[model samples]
Target: MKNFNIRSLMIFILFFSLKISAQNSYINQYKTIATELSQEFGIPTVVILSIAYMETGGGTSSACKVLNNHFGMTGRNNVNSSRFKNFTDSKASYRAFCEWVSKRKFYEKLKGSQDHNDWFVAIASSGYSTKPVEWKQKLNLVMKKIGL
Candidate 1:
């Protein structure tokens, strides 16, 4: 039993290490794009990264895999279906998200702010997600986990 417990603990550590590594890779892959979008859209870098991470499940979601939509945006663009919008590339998806956010009423009000909480509140209140409270909570958790 002691040996089994030791093996299980090692396995758990290995699994979590891999998970963290993958997550770090995902963040690094998108961080530059997110930063560029943040500069262009006046949104915080942390906000863009956290939302993308949460929506895409660290770039493993079906929408991201098949549609190249990291933001879970719904509409018809590249694809015929009026579901998730398909982009020519992942960068396009990120650009589209920035554009959408730039058009929001609160954009000018909170532009270039580094406060993640403010961005979360504005986004949630703007009906970005159906569950505003829960969405903000999840964003907070993701930001914390990612050490942002």
Candidate 2:
């Protein structure tokens, strides 16, 4: 019993450390992407991350698995409509999202304006209509929670 307890304790500690490390990696990734997106699109990094988190559960969801897409991107890119895969790797998805925003093409055309407050609603409207209102609220709430 004593040996078992010690082994369990060590295992718990190892898992705890791994969890913290994973979180740190995620934060670092978000920070890097946010910096790039902020520079390119003039949107707040936290807001961008909030959108990503909501769309792909911070890179743990299946939509991200098949889509390589973080922003709930629809349809295809570079491939025929039929051949297009649904997933984009986490990093690539974020990069693609940022590029789409920065260029004012594709997804950019979907937005009515660049106004911060209007963003959530605009995106929410674009196919996100069903979840638009809730996502907007959540996105705004996340921005507040993160001090963004």
For each candidate in turn, give its C-alpha RMSD to the true structure in angstroms. 1.5, 5.7
Indicate which candidate wins on lDDT: 1
Tens digits of per-residue lDDT, candidate 1, 14-104, equal 9999999988988999999999888888898899999999999999998898899999999886655648888999999999988888889
For candidate 2, give the lDDT. Answer: 0.64
TM-score, cand. 2: 0.58
lDDT, candidate 2, 1-148, per-residue tens: 9999999999999998886575455556677876676666666566577787667665666565555666776666653454333543566777776665655433454333445556666556655447777778888875564445
